[model samples]
Structures are given as structure tokens and as C-alpha cells.
Target: MQQQTLVNFQNFIIATRDSGYKSTASALAELVDNSIEAGATKVEILINKVQEQGVEQYEVLIIDNGKAMSEDELNLALQFGGSSRFNSRNQLGRYGMGLPNSSLSQCRRVEVVTWKKKGEFLSNYLDVDEVIDKSLTRLPKPKKSTNCVFSIQSKSGTIVLWKKCDRLSFKYLKSLIKHVQFELGRVFRYSIWRGVEIRICGETIRPFDPLFIGEGVNLKGGLPYGEELHYQVKIPNNEKKTSVVKVRFVELPVQEWAKLPNEEKRKSQITKCAGATILRANREIDYGWFFMGDKRKENYDDWWRCEVSFEPELDEVFGVTHTKQEIKETEFMSSILVPDIEQTARALNNRVRLKFIDLKRIQPQVFSKQQLERNDMYLPPVKKNDGLVKKNNGSLKIKGLEYEIVTKELKRDVFFDVEEVDNCIVLTVNTAHIFYEKIFKALHSRRINNIAD
Candidate 1:
């Protein structure tokens, strides 16, 4: 009865494996994930096409230098939800839908070939079409073959060959490769950046480190919206332990960002300067949403993103769905994350609002009149009847952001100064000239350049 119940549950899960993921790329990412979790330093993916039954069938072959499985372990790996990492500590795979379910979801047959360390090779193939046939009384063991063409020479490693890929089309295959390449580059860029080599079709995959440290891009200066807000919170399950949440906002330099043309701006903006980057066990997963909540606007698409990282203990609190594609905010996580994030979001919103203000005050007059009269000194003039002319009077507007105006007057700044009050923080910004003077003087002189150098 127990075995029968297990079989039924396995069937139910396998049936639903293809539910949320839209394409083969996301499905295949699961297998790559398993390889990474298995301590593979290198992973190779190869794609091939063949003709069968008057249709072109594609096959995806993934080979990894991860730990190989024994016969019993191999059998358990194919079974749905039969994860060895279920009760283990700090593993990338816990749910166990990554191997057989993920592969069978995208293909009609999956062949897994593994060779243990200093041991013989073993191969098995599963035909999902046969398992799904209602006429079958019970599914038999996967077919074994003496011809192990998918064999690996490693002392301990695994290789998976996916055949009869019914879900993959030629067009879909191309798109899947591109999408998976980007997602894998983004999600696991750290691994690649940290010296792990990954290859696709014999070509090495370059790490896409958005922080721009790889390929000679380095971060030298301090972040634009500079104060780091750090908080200490207790881990939910482990009462004795605690987790730290820190929020620091940064805006790219206007000069550097403006060097790109309009087209580049539109394309680069989404992945720029940190948005909502969710990390588990110090590895980044999802990056940049800004919590727009379906509201679309051109301004929000500007170059700004936040990096959200947390320990793996927050996974359940973050509602890690089966696909692991996204996180559903639970009360425990939201209660802490939302409020903290909202603070940073509010700061970003203020910066955006100020940009408009600066534009309204300066654009028309400066571009039309002032630059013309000053022999194109680079500053433009505004229309006389406009209220923006009076708003700044004799101040310069900061590029990209409008909330900040460089005026001789004391009452037009819009930066927040939050002070810790009992139980909560109170924010205030009342004609604060001290900070403004300090920043302006610092940016105004040649000494600042030397300091930066």
C-alpha cells in the first residue's frame, strides 16, 4: 500500500511538472541548477537535431562534473520528490523536481548516464508516453542499454541526455538557448565569475556580472544616495540566530549614463544600478522589478535597481514556489522586507520626482534663451511666463533627477533626514543647509577630484 501510494503521488507530480514554466529554457534551467547543487565546477550543454517519424526532433544533452550517483541513488533521483537534500542543510535543491520531472516535462524520453568515482557506468532511459498510457498496469524499470554513448570519462560525474523532445521547436530551441543563456548568466553569474567554467556547444559562457566587475569594469566611487541603513532581525525558525538586512541606494552618474544613445538607454535601463535582486545563500536569483505592481511608466524604467540578498532561512518566509522562478511574499518576509524596501523605494521616488521639477524649471528657458545669449555656454534659458523660472531663480538643475536644485537660496532641497524615534523612525527635511553646503562645497572644488583619486 505504501509503495502504491508513493507511485500515485509520483505520477501526480510528474503530470504537473509542465504547469508553470512557459518554455524549454526555464525547464532546462532546473537541470543546470541540480548540477550546480551537486558541486559541479564545470557544466556543458549540447543541442542536436534528428529526423524521426517525418518530424524533426531535437535532443538536449547536458554533461556535468558533479558527484555521480550509485544505483540506488540514481533510482531515487528519478523518483519525484525523492530528494536526498530534503532534510540536509544549505543545499540548492530541496524540492527535488529538478531532475526527472524537469526533463520529462520537456521531452518524451530522458536518458541519464552516470559513472561513480572509480566505478562502472550505468545508464537508464524513461519513456513518459508509456508511463502515461492508461492501459498499462504498472510502469516498469527504465530500459538499460549496453551502448552507453552518453558516457563521461570523469572519475565521478553525471550526464543527462534528453531525447524525443516533443516540446521543442526549431524557433523555440533558438529562443530557449538565448533566454536560458541570459537567465543562467544572470542567476548564476556569481559561480562563473568565481572561477567555475560553464560551456554551451563548446563555447565558454562569459559571466554577466551586472555589478560590472568582470571584463575590466570596476566600481570605484561611493554610491550616489549614500547612507547605508542596516538592521538586525531574528531568523524565524532559528531563534538563537539572527539575520541582517541592509539597504543602500545608488544612482549612476549622469555623464556616464548620457554617453549612451537613446536606444542604449532603453535597453540597459532595466538591468541597471540594482533593483529587486533576491539572493539565497549569498547567490543572486531574481533582479530588478521595483515593485511596480503592473503600473507602467517611462520614468520608472530609468537606470535604477536594488540588490536584495538574504540567507536561505528566508526561503519559506518568501514563499518559494515550485518553479523557483519567483518569490511570493509571505507575511513574515513582507513585514520586514516591505517596510524596509518601501523606505528605499520612497527615496528613489523622491529622486525621480525631483528630476521632473528640474526639467520643468530649466529645460525650455535654458535650451532656447540662456544658451543662445551666453554664446552656447551649455546652459539654456526658460520662457518668461513659466513658474519654473521663479522656482529655481538662479540655480542649476541636476541631470536625471529633478528633486535637487543648486540654488543660492536655503529652502528648496528635498533630501530626507530620518531620525530614530521610539518604536519607529521620523523623517524630516526642513531647509537643511548644512548637508547641502557640505555636498556642494565637496563637489565644487578641485580638492574633491584629488580625494577621489
Candidate 2:
């Protein structure tokens, strides 16, 4: 039998390009993963807007100060599923498909240049146009190339250039930069926290801890709810071997953050974000309702968070994909981890609900605060102040609606007075009235005593 080609090079390359990389950020992440595995401390992603045939297009250049590759290593890195660190359980890379696969998914041509010794740069590339035309049967031999990445280098570095781009997201420039930075920050929060610096278009990417329990964040949440869950999950590749999986839960400050502006809540990714962040080897892969069987999500659930982290050895258990954007369903994962997680999730939801209930109980006037917005935010502001001197009025706004409840000595015979101040409505009960000395004071005392019951 005459041995024929295993795959149609033209069609395969095109199909591979289309098959991989669901998002521009995911593809870029693969390249950065390689850089991190190479021990890169500093990485930069530069976005360039170029005009091609009267149309505006974008090109990306990824530069890293990692250990550069030699000619032989560079050749292998350019090939599909080729890596010296294949199946590496400790490092970020595993299948070795990241470099070329990630690059071609965004652009038609990708050139990689690397150097360890000064003035001895090695370069290689894979061009979609060449493969389709059959002019370039294989990767052109890596040769000495000009140091296009940097003019000066200490010892080693690598540069990846993407050209003829087509598969980028619809957003560009500011939008694209913002999206990438947000995603990279969340996905690589651990790496960033570990002193890895990632800059996009000269702007430094900050770590965005989903749980909101870390420092340097504008928002904060309560401490971890319970003890960390540890599981020695079996590694799919080696049935006899197993790895560690850590699970933790956190409760966001519902009473503290529930009154923030809608935009701030949305920007902080707290509203409607009731899910766990699945981390593999300290890198976030999937973030959703994982390992929580039959648990329906609710508004109160948003007040809590979960994080499940595992070693690279248990990738199959987590159903991690090559894209690493999301996880697929795994029977082993569900059967092993779901019960405990689901139970804890329910407890957390109940805790949040009860906390809100307690808040309402402590502040019986909370309903007034709620109504200030539901029934009256559309009303015009009051320019006419209350006919009294304002000192320590203790007036405040909640969700942009001003409200106050205080006791004051009213010269009138009324039990209470309702006055609209500049920005709020003040409900002042007469302190000298019999309603305060008898009904109001006694009622509050009984309610306070009921707390012990």
C-alpha cells in the first residue's frame, strides 16, 4: 500500500485554525502560558492598528523576557503538539499545541523569534497562505534573524508576531484592551499575585480576585466560610496516581455592598456572579456552577463564592479543554465533589438570607430606606429644608435615596413629624410625647428582648 499523507495539509491547517481558540483572549492566554512556563517574569502584549487595503486591522505582538529557545527547540515549538514539556504536571503547558495553535487561530501568519545568546536570534513561522498554496510544504528552517523584539537584551527573551489577523473579537483598541485586561486579570490572578507582571498596551494588568477577599481591591468580603475541602482525586492518565484538589467558599458583605451603585456592582462583577472559579495549577480554567448538583441559583447565592483548584494531573477530572475557557461535564467530577459543595452552597445561601433578615430586624426602618427608592427616586429633590437648625442630623442616603429616622423634641402636640430636607425625608418622633415614653420605647424594648429568644 502506497503511504499517503495522514491529513490534507491545506484543509487541516485551515480547519485547525478555525477549530481552536474560542476567544481572542483565550488564544493570547495560550501564548502567555508558554511564556510563564518559560519562567517569564515580565510580559507585554502590544496592539497595533494597521491599514490593510483601505481597511483597518489589528496585529498583536507578544514579548516575554523568558528563557529563549535554541534553533532545535524553536523548530519543535513551531510544530503542532510539539513541546519539550509535554504532559508537564507542574508547569502551565501540557499538550504543547499552545504556541502554533494559539497563534494561527487569530491570524494567518505567525512568526516566532527567540534568542539566548546576544546577537544569535533563531526564528520560525507557520503561514496559512503558504500551506494552502503548497509552496511551503513545512516550517521553514529556523535561521539567524534580526532581533526585532528589543534592541538590548540581557541574556534571553522571546517574541511572537501575529499578521493578517482575522479572528479577533469585534471590539478593538480601548474595548479590546479592556476586555483582555479584565479576563487576564481574573484568569491569572494567582500568577499576578505572585509577582508576574503583565502589561497590555503599556497599561499594567491588576489581579481581580473574584472572592473580593484580597487586598488592593475596592471591595471586600467576609473570611472563608468553612475549612478548606481537600480531595485526592485520581489522575485520569495514571489511574494509580492521584492529585490534590482544594475547595473554599467566601461570603461577600451583602449588607455593606448591597447599596452600591448598579454600575459599580456590575463593574465589580458581583451581581449575578454566583459561581466557582476552577483553578488548575494556580491558573483559572473554568468559572461556573461546577460540582454543585441539583442546586438552583438564586439572588441570595450571589452573596457567596466558591473556588476549586486542582493540579494539572487531574485535568480530566475537571473536564478541562484545550481552550481552558470553560470546563466540560465529567462524571467523576460530579460524583466525587458535588455533594459536599452543593450542601455548603445551600448553607451559604441560607446564611446570606438570614443575615439580610437580621439586618432588617435590627433596622426596622430599613423598609423606609427601601421605599425611598422604590416609591420616590423619580421625585424632584427638595430645595426647601426642614424649618430647623441641622446639627448631627444623622441623615444619609441609600441607593441614592435620602432617608432619616430620629427622635426630636417637637413643640407641637403631634406624636411625630414628617419633614423633607434638602436630599432626604426626616421622620422625627417627638421625644417628649407619651408615644415615645410608653408605646415606642416599650415596643423597641420588647423587640430587643425577643432577639434572645
Candidate 3:
């Protein structure tokens, strides 16, 4: 006899596994976010290729030195949308559909073990097979775990083990590690800058600043295009209230880098990356063509970059979905950002074009970097245990993120302020600036929802 349930539990688990994550790294990032929230200074992702029952596959273990959970909390972690953290997300586009959503998205089973002290450990798990077979009705009760497969020496922390990973994007271990390496470094660059050490199979990850303006970077000499542009936007549902949206642009060095070997350029990720970076509180939600009006992207445009940063308060204004993978276009938001962004993008593109044309005039000389440019360009690419830079005698020095924009309310009358905070040149835009009045009032005057002239 079939029980009349509101929704099929077994079918739901099978369908939820395909939750459309952009990549394995993105899904893994949700778990990392949990660690960071729990005050984890170090996070380790251990993946092992093994044979189970004559079938070869891989198992993933993410261990973090974060605050441990109680038995009640361990049970909450496995239930779908059971944790309060997901419901009340303070960070924009982060952890809303957390833990279970992300874990099961790539694996058939997830086991979580947490501990408050070394002696006592609480463990629980959710298995797709168990649910489908109707052997599991509710989440299994937490039990004492003495010997965890992935345990840290610290006094407390949490471990999330992913088994039967049948839906991982990169089946090959090497490719998956590389993808995780780049993704973690870029997405959590700000956190790493603060002091988080993320390791995959023991190799520490380096923060990959997309701006490419920092020192020790392969391609250098990127400078702020101009004074950072500031705009105040009206908060939805409250016409009288408003929030701030800031825009900044970067001018990459095209004349100097254009002379590098094609292979070297590709390695540095400078060949064809062109578009705006959307940042909402630290995490880079979306990166691609944004607010360029009707201008078609060209190869020359790759030389420059743009960052559109906004508060989570403006998530509704920007149309940020829970997945945080994308930001939809809104008629109200586009009008405020398009003109300046489009104009600056064109100007930077023209600058790169002109620089390339001028470089042809100078006599070529073998620069210092020429000898070391291609250490082993011909000898196949390194896949395993590789960080951002795999050469230069396996050493890469980084100070921190080179550029950032921070917003604050000021008591004094000022449009913007610039100061150095934690090694990066921080641009503190005054959201309370009177400029917002001129912009917001103008926007409210012209409503665009209804048609007809």
C-alpha cells in the first residue's frame, strides 16, 4: 500500500541532486562558507580515488577547524532547509540553500561528523540509497563517533564526507582539483586575504585576484581607471529609502603583456577575459558582459576589467537569485549603471587598441622575463598538486588583494575617501553623498514599467 505523502521523499532526493550548480567548486564553496562562518581558519578538501565493490570512483572529505555542532545541530545539518543559517542569510547570495543542497547536488550520500571536544563526537548522515529503498524515513539519530576517517587534531571542528560522487562535473581527479584551486582562490580571495588557509590534498591555495593589479602577478601595471563612480539607488517597496551601488574599472597593461608568448598569456588567464565582475559582500557572484549597452565585446576589450559592487540590501534591486550564480537584468537597475560603464569600457578598449598599435613601433628586446617565460611550455601541463603558478621553482609570493571598494556612511560632507586598509588601496565611497539625491530623484521622476509615449 502506497502511503499518501504530500511529496515523494525518494523522488525528491533524486531530483534535488541536479540542482544546477555551475561547477563542483561552487557547490563545495557552500560547505566552505559554513566553515568560515563557524570561524574556521583552515579548511582542507581531501579527495581519494578508490575502488568500492569493484567499481572505481572517488570520495571527498572536507575538514575544517571550525566550531563544532551539538547532536541537535548535527541532525539539523542533514535536513533540507532545516538550519536557521540558510533562512536568515546575512551575506548576499550565500548559504541560503546550504549544506545538504550543495552536498547532495554532487554526491549520493553525505555524512557529517562534528565535535565540541576531542573525546565526544556526534555523527549523522543522509543516504540517497537508504531513502529510495524506504529504509530511512526521517534523519537517522546522531551517534557517538570515535574514529572519523577525516579528523583534525584541533580541540573542535567539523567534517563533511561526500560518498558515491556520481554527479561531479570533473570526473578526473586532476581536472577537478585544478577547478577547485582556481575557484576557491578567486571566490574567497577576500577571506584568504584576511587569513584563511585552504588546502586541497595538502597544497595551500593562493588568492587569485582577477583585477591583476597586485605585485608578483605575471601580468602587472593595472591601475584604477579613474575616480571610482558612485551612485545611490532607491530601495524597492520603500520609495523614501535608498541604498548605494558603486562601480569601479581597471586598466590592464596591454602594451607590455601583448609581447608575451601566446602560451604564457593563456597560462596567466589574460588572453580573453573581458567583462564586469559583480561583487556582493566578498563573494564574486557573476562575471561576464554586464551593462555594456549594445556594444559588442572584442578581443581588445580583454585588457581592462570592471567591478560592480553593491550591498545585499540591493540584492532585490539587482535581481540576485538564491543560487548567486547569476544576476538578472532589471529595467530600473540598468538605466542607473549602463551609460558610465559602457562609456568607460569603450575608452579602455580604445586605449588597449592604441597601445598595441604603438608597441609595433618600438624595437623588440629580450626582457628579463623572456628566459623564464616558458619553464616547460612544451612539456605537457602540470595537473596535480598545482597552485595558481606551477613554475618559478614552485614559489609564488603574494601580499594581498590589490584593489577594493568599501562603502560607509560619513558625517562630514564628502563624495568619497581613499585610504590603505590591510595592504589594499581601499576606496571608501560615501553613500550619504548628496550626489545620490541628484541621481535618485531623477530616476524616480521617470518610471519605465508602463508602455506608450
Expressed as tens digits, the lDDT of each residue in 73-112 for candidate 1 is 7777776666777644376666766777778777877888
Backbone collision count in every prediction? 17, 0, 0
Q: How far does residue 88 in candidate 2 sit from its true spot (Å)?
A: 2.7
> Order the candidates by lDDT, highest first — what do you get?
2, 3, 1
| Reference-based TM-score of each model | 0.69, 0.82, 0.76
Give the winner by lDDT.
Answer: 2
Indicate the worst ten consecutive residues by lDDT in candidate 1.
397-406
- Measured with C-alpha atoms, the lDDT of residue 363 in candidate 3 is 21
Candidate topping TM-score: 2
Ordered from best to worst TM-score, the candidate numbers read 2, 3, 1
Instruction: State the lDDT at 131 in candidate 3.
Output: 94
Residues 19-54 of candidate 2 have per-residue lDDT tens digits of 557688888899889889889999899999999899
In candidate 2, where is summed lDDT lowest over 10 consecutive residues?
Answer: 444-453
In model 2, which residue pairs have backbone atoms overlapping below 3 Å? none
Which runs of model 3 end up more than 4 angstroms from their true locations?
Answer: 1-4, 92-96, 146-149, 215-218, 237-241, 363-453
Candidate 1: where are CA atoms >4 Å away?
A: 1-14, 87-89, 134-147, 151-153, 169-173, 210-233, 245-248, 269-274, 288-301, 352-453
